[model samples]
Target: MPQMLLIVEPIGQRAERGRADGEAVYQRMLDFAAELQAEGLLLGVNSLGSAAKRLAKRDGGAQVWDGPFAEAKEMVGGYFLLDTEDEGVAMAWAERCPAAEWATVEIRGVGPCYM
Candidate 1:
């Protein structure tokens, strides 16, 4: 079995005006994650801060960018560290994700860090 990082991106405005009701949806999303955790399927899940507070590192200087990195349908607002046997199993979880049908889940494996 391998550990995979499941990054979730919301396809619509998740934290903005007119989307105030989004809080409820967000709560549901949390509930789903909790359920997964209780089943020992999910290792951990975390929500990221607004993209407005993001900083990009270049050659020398750090560039501060606005929140919500892209104008696409969704933005990566959170992630889950999944402990799964393979990508197929991980995809199964992603398909069940509340945000999956609408949002996108980018799966990445933990790589070796050369000393």
Candidate 2:
């Protein structure tokens, strides 16, 4: 089976609506993931929080930056790893995502890993 990753961007102008609406959208996302799993198309799903830590190499050792990434216009909110036959099927699945209307969903094929 081919594997694909669905990158979900949850931060945007429309996404800042209201607390109740945000919760509703979150529930819908969970429901959609459950439906995908029930159909055996979902391998895994992850919800990413706003907090992030960036690591970098400087002159001597490591440098770190923390985030809610104040300057970013969009941040990845979550992802869905899908197992399917081909890109067409994966694209169809991506199209059915609950937040597709307001958020950005990027579908990318998973390549073989050396490690």
- Cα lDDT of all candidates, in order? 0.68, 0.77
Candidate 2 residue pairs that clash: none
- Tens-digit lDDT string for candidate 2 (1-115): 5655555565554346778887887899899889888998888888777678999998889988988677876877778888776888788888898867877778877766652
Best by TM-score: 2
TM-score, one value per model: 0.67, 0.81
Residue 48 error for model 1, in Å? 1.6
lDDT of 2 at 97: 87
List, in order, the clash count of every candidate structure: 6, 0
Per-residue lDDT over 83-114 for candidate 1, one digit per residue giving the tens place of the 0 to 100 score: 77678877777777776754677776655675
TM-score of 1: 0.67
